[model samples]
Target: MKLSAHVEKVPLIHPFHITGYTFTHNDLLVVKLQDGTHVGVGEALGVYYKHDTPYTMLEQVEALRPTLEHGITRKELLELLPPGGARHAIDAALWDLEAKQRDMPVWQLAGMEPPRPLLTTFTLGADEPEVMATEARGFEGVRAIKLKLTDDALNAERVRAVRAACPDAWMMIDANQGFTRETLASVLPAFVEARVAVVEQPFPVGKEDWLDGLDCPIPIALDESIQDHRDLGLAVGRAQVINIKLDKCGGLTEALILAHKAQEMGFKLMVGNMGGSSWSMAPGFVIGSLCTVVDLDGPIYLSADRTPAVSYHDGHIWCPETVWGGPVAA
Candidate 1:
């Protein structure tokens, strides 16, 4: 097998803002593995909050050159790389390579039922309340809208602005580990008042315990708090929703098992992304089929997407097998 990867800096249409970060472009790690005549590709945007950059992700993948060249399986990969973007890119490439080798699709390999178009949430970055409201209105009645929020006192006002702009669209918010116990409490009423569907990562990662006995009506979803399946135990009594991101869990291999086990453990599932290109969102789209909430809109943020891309249509994200993890590579 021949392993090669590069950093592709894809510019974003707009500067993307969350609680602790701002991005003008996504520096993606695109990994390609060649076995015989077949080539497989995977894209990854490393976890930003962890200070993961394309160079760091590339270094991690390069460190596993010997193992990958010698041929590694997804299950074996779990033992090798701790969960993060490097492992995710490699694992996804391996899955794609194996799928092509077997002349089948990844969903079939995973024994999942055939996938269909799923309603995916479009995100509005943290901005002036009116700016967010304007962006929310631009979605033109999107089925779901996910808002980026901060710890500021104006969070409730931001929620209300978007709600007023798109009264019919279902709403969710992600503070991206921005809030404290006190600020969260102050904002909880606004979330409920605006009828926000879920409040994601409102409190910082280690502050999940603050949720204990807090009277909140909105479902609390965990993002930064839950990485791979091993972290599920932390959310058992703390959060109602578990968000799975490929970059955090390793890749589709772990994400599939994580989602299944999370569901069995009685948590609502969410599949999210790290703002890679459409290729990065492809694998997540498969997991999205099983999730109650989907936020795989990374490609839409990109200034340009690769050919055979995952597309958004009719307020849904559609990933054709040709986009990834099939006999034909994207």
Candidate 2:
């Protein structure tokens, strides 16, 4: 078997900013595993918010040369590395390889009875409220739209614009850990008035307990606040929803497990993304089928993606043929 990796810096068509900072480009790690016959590929985008950089993720993968060259099992792969971008890329490639090897779909091997179509949240990038609202109103068949919010004082105006643009749209907001208690309190009322469905990770992780039992008008979602399945125990009662990002939870293996656990705990599920090409959206596409809200619009941000890019024909993303690779779209 042979293992190889490289990084692709994908420039966002438009600069993307949340509350914290603006990201102009994403460094993606692409890995290829082959046994001198079939080839399997996967990718992960470097996430700055998680303290992850392309250089760091590359070093981590290089350090795992021994394991990669040894034909490591997926379970051993999990035990060998802590959850992050590197494992996510490699694990996904392995799943793709295994499915191709057996001539079956990856979902079939994972024990998912039948694959179903998924509805994903159309994300309105960080921009003025009126501009974001214009983008939201243009979307078709998207049951939910997650707006990226910031610490700026104009949050109320932004919410108002979006609500006015899509009065009937099921709306949600993600602060990306960009708000304070006072600021969040001030905006929660406006968000509720605008019928914003849920607010996500308004504060940083540890401080999230501040909202525990506070009873805000809208439900709160935990994004950066929750890490892995272990973190679930601490967040179970505190958060109304869990935004599961495969890169954050390790890979699809842990993501599925965490989703099941979150479901059992009565928390709503929201599959999210960190931004990449179509490849980055593949794993999340499968997970979105089982979640209440889906935020897998990572591919849409890229200038160009791998062939057969996850087709977003209405508001639904099609995953008939892996979507990451395998066949080119006609």
- Report the C-alpha lDDT of model 1 over 10-108, residue by residue, as the tens digit: 899999888767899989999999998998898898887887777899999999899889988889999998888998999889888888999999888
Poorest lDDT segment (10 consecutive residues) of candidate 1 = 321-330
lDDT of 2 by residue, 1-330 (tens): 688889988788878878868888888998888866767788886556778765687788889887787897778888987888888888888877776777777776777756566777788877988788777877766666888888888898998998888777788999888888889888888898999988899887688677777658788889887877888876766778999998888788889989999999999999898998888888787777788888888877778788767777667777766564332223
Model 1 alpha-carbon drift over 4 Å, by segment: none
Give the clash count for each candidate. 0, 0
lDDT of each: 0.89, 0.81
- Model 2 earns a TM-score of 0.94
Task: Write down the lDDT that model 2 would get.
Answer: 0.81
lDDT winner: 1
Clashing pairs in 2: none
Scored by TM-score, the top model is 1
Alpha-carbon TM-score of each model against the true structure:
0.97, 0.94
